[model samples]
Target chain A: MPIPSPTVITAATLDLRGRPVFVRSTGTTDGPALILLHGLPTSSWLWRRCLPDLAEALPGWRIIAPDLPGYGRSAPRPGAGPRHLGGWLHALLTTLGVDRFALVGHDLGGLVALTDAVARTGRLGGTPHPARTGGPQLERLLLLNTTIYPAPLLVLGLLPSIVPPFADLSLVWLGRGGAARDDDRRKGYVVGMRQLLAPGTVVEAVEWAEYARPYGPIAGWREARRSLRALAWQAPFVLRCLAHLGDLTLPTRLIWSRHDPFFPLAVAERLRRAIPGAEPMIHIIEGAAHFPQEDQPAEVARLIAEFLREPR
Target chain B: MPTHTPVRYVLTSHVEEHGGRPAAATHAEIFEQVALADSFGFDALWLAEHHFGAQAGMVSQPLLVALAAATRTRRINVGTSLIVLPLHHPLMLAEQLSTLNLLTEGRLSIGFGSGSAPFEFAGFDAPFDGERRHPRFREALEVIERAWTGEPFSHEGTNFQIGEVRLVPRPTRPLREFAWLGAMSEQTAAMAGEFGYGLQLPRGQSADHYAAPIGAFRAALRDTWGPDAPERLAIARCVYVGTDDETAIAEAGPSIRRFYEHSKGYDKTKPTPAAPELIERLHFIVGGPEKCAREIAAFVAATGISHLSIQPIWEGLEHGQAIASLRRFGAEVMPRAEALIGAERAAGVAGQD
Candidate 1:
């Protein structure tokens, strides 16, 4: 059934850990909350494809998505790396009075969510705790194309770049990449997404343009580059996130893309067992790759709706 | 995975004799500057190589001055900005550098340039016309390197004719001295790359003007040298960091304007057209700590050059004030700028697919 367009979506910049973090929210005023987070080379735009379906299928379920500090229109706070953003995420949720919510994370966002969960759980004595006391309550956890094992490519690519002499070369490296003109950068991002998604995926030009805004003429690209380099340079935070990989004990689900190159089906299966007490039910979206949310949005949306209705 | 070479914080001394300080006091002050810089972890310290400029405390005998400096400072690298290659015989200069290297434990570097002042060329009985200076400078560099090898070699190039003669005392690290060419034009910059020589860009040019030379060097590196030939890519800047922006400008403004106005002996060119537009683009990274960090980060982001050699003293700015600026940059500005750059780089990689 085609989802109705009665859903309301609005955007705002909220004070998040002292940086102006841009947020996109949906659903009625008083409703169960769900916070969606995106991964690399994308912003809140990643959630646009699935929001209509989610809002129509589950009315009154508040959906909140933020363009992680430095990702989208958010004013990047100081040092928004992997170790840092999760704390900012917690601060954002606390500021919104979002004490309890279902958390869904993809790629780096997934790692950040898991970090947030472990941190909150660690603070609340590992049990169902009152929200007013402290920290957000994670009712259910969901992972998609998320980083679990420190994949050699991800870990190794950033390793030497953070070391002393090489660490100093980060600006040179970023400058080279950022030198691409705005149009060329836009085209590059689209070409990159094609390699990451299912082959022959027809991404509309308008959609691509929306994603390309950050890599623009001057100010936008500089802002994006500054924010991005800050996160990539945080090696210590990457280590901390990797250390807490096995602590997600919430009622969890892992819906993965069948052809995902970054995290294969086998990796997803391993994650089912790796989330300590998760015993996650894994669903595979067939016509997708690293980004099932984009390549097969309908299937992803259906899987999410079904998962939300499951008996706890 | 990638790693970087060490980014150097070199100190440049124009040796402007502030307020009639005795020449001995000025020389002592230069040595004291080197000692202070060595303690603060500066990569290399250099005094300008100007001659016949009585007002400027130019170190005409650079190797001798460096030899003297090496005695007081344990670690700071000592060198001269430009030692007019045509003024001295290449073999004798090579021999002196070899001896200085031995004395300094291989801590000496030399920046060789074709003398620009026609009068200085006339004083040395060398040609004052265009093209004559550079060919002599270039040929001298070639002969110097060939002679330093300590192997019997004969060179029969124009302006130089030497028999198969090997020196008795060779340099400790022959052919290892950091030899750079001061590139003021595209040809020079590209030549620096093609000949595998380090580049010392003329001081005070804005970042926007650096692209052509950097690009030219890179192209030469790829096509001719097969390496980014510069042993170090050094650019000079005038910097002043204070507790705040207004104060920094207020403190550094007059001397800087004086530098543009009267410091003609520092560079061979007509005193920099420090016109209103040019003055607006002064190489002074003048501001408070955070503001300086932001400006410097932007500069690095624009130009990927590695070594930044800064002149903190001169044109009536006192020695004590120069020390404060250096300390502020070394202890406060650089660290904060590094943190900002690191975070920006980290965020950039994370944002990439």
Candidate 2:
């Protein structure tokens, strides 16, 4: 007997604090909620596989994957960096009526989730914010292949600080090139994205197209450039949030791909040690690169489910 | 026109001792047999889960064995003849099976049973009382099904209290599509039907003994899921095919007797009646191709089973002999049996028309 494919995924745009936030969601809305945040250059579409499977695995729970502001279908908040994005996420969740839920983030999204978690802990600069009082409570936090401490070699971290104009020009070139005329350039961009996955992992052409779709337009490149530039300014605040990670009391699990070139396993190790009660919470998935969700979605899903199901 | 329900032949194994060989050797032979079965176009290969006594069976985790078998052969669906559900946590089981499903690219089937062995439950430190066991099994099944839905669910049951949690990686497909309920009682068979799962009849039982459960299962299935609901009833039987009846008996008779003797020895409470004729009639299907085919057709005709899960290898049987038996069964017995079944069904349809 063959297993049936997952439920139909519903995509919608929500007006969060007057910004059009594009979201892809599945499962029942009334169940316990799980929100998925995708990393840089990718949209909620990063969780195309994870959403349906996670929703199916966790019936009754609402599984929401949102294109973070400035990425995918969401309109870019011109000056919003990681900190601002984190605040925006809280507002988005609050607007969606998700009072309490688990959060999973990858890459830049991980930084955002961590920022949100730190802010919620009332440990950000040792001062409690108003949002901490009545905001959506994070039941659990799962980070994948993301970094907290700034590394000069960090692609997202380095792009804005070192070569902002060059990065901007490259994005424009990659975005503006027509599909038929610049097939090689589009293929090169897809190949670059494929490099983020484990070597030899066969990603279908159509899937690559979905990943590249957002970046096909000038708006996508403009949003990507803005996010990159904003990260350079958000560095100090993100580091400060990182300093207060020890104060976080919520359950945290770190899943890192062993061969991630940008953020190595050492980054996960550091975060694991910094967070309270997270000593035994780190899992290293082998045979995967930066995008473990794409390289090994099953393992990623298993780890997430296992960690979430663990008694709080 | 009435359509014929084609009987699917699946090879099953307990991974039992073969001539005092090591457990590793037995596992290797099972994989080899699995490859052979796959090559011969068997519908699936099911492995039984057992614990404690090494001589009784080596397989404690049928899913792991199934995974190994799945990797070794392509196209053949691998399954647990029955995983002892009450002993393991349902969430963990769901996760592992889901991983197996993904790894195998969805060539996986599962048979779940509330195991009968008291010692097996004792080893796992689980409750063995029928009163507790039955409910726990039922609750676990409920949890597993809910987990497969990839939806967040909370369960506060008699045996388990699960907080809001969902199964990860979600199953490639709904696990129920490939799930079977291994029923030892008419009540369980009815429950399998009520749940809309396939029903797997146990081995070493008479056709008369199985009739009630089969009837209950089909009736419940029709009543609950409508008449169009698939009657995926599978029966496990000891089957061996040879060039002639004399050759078949000479090769398989002693091993067949020893198999029953070992089974009786394990329980001690059950009668150790290993009369060759009675065993031949009820348990073993050892004969030449023609005879094996005829018996298989008759059994299918009588029981109305959609699948036949055959144990071609037994304790003390040579691995080569088992392979040869499987070869003959695949090349001769299977096609002949299928032809006979088709003819019988066609005749029945003609009579109706």
Docking class of 2: incorrect
Query: Candidate 2, overall lDDT?
Result: 0.79
In candidate 1, position B249 carries an lDDT of: 77
DockQ leader: 2
- Against the reference, the lDDT scores of all candidates come to 0.69, 0.79
Q: Pick the candidate with the highest TM-score.
A: 2
Give model 1's share of reference contacts.
0.00
Candidate 2 stretches greater than 4 Å from native: A1-312, B265-278
Q: How accurately is candidate 1 docked according to DockQ?
A: 0.01
Residues A144-231 of candidate 1 have per-residue lDDT tens digits of 8776455432442455344322232334345454555556655655665667778766778898788767655445444444544544
lDDT (tens digit, per residue) of candidate 2 on A67-92: 98877788777678777776788788
lDDT of 2 at B258: 68
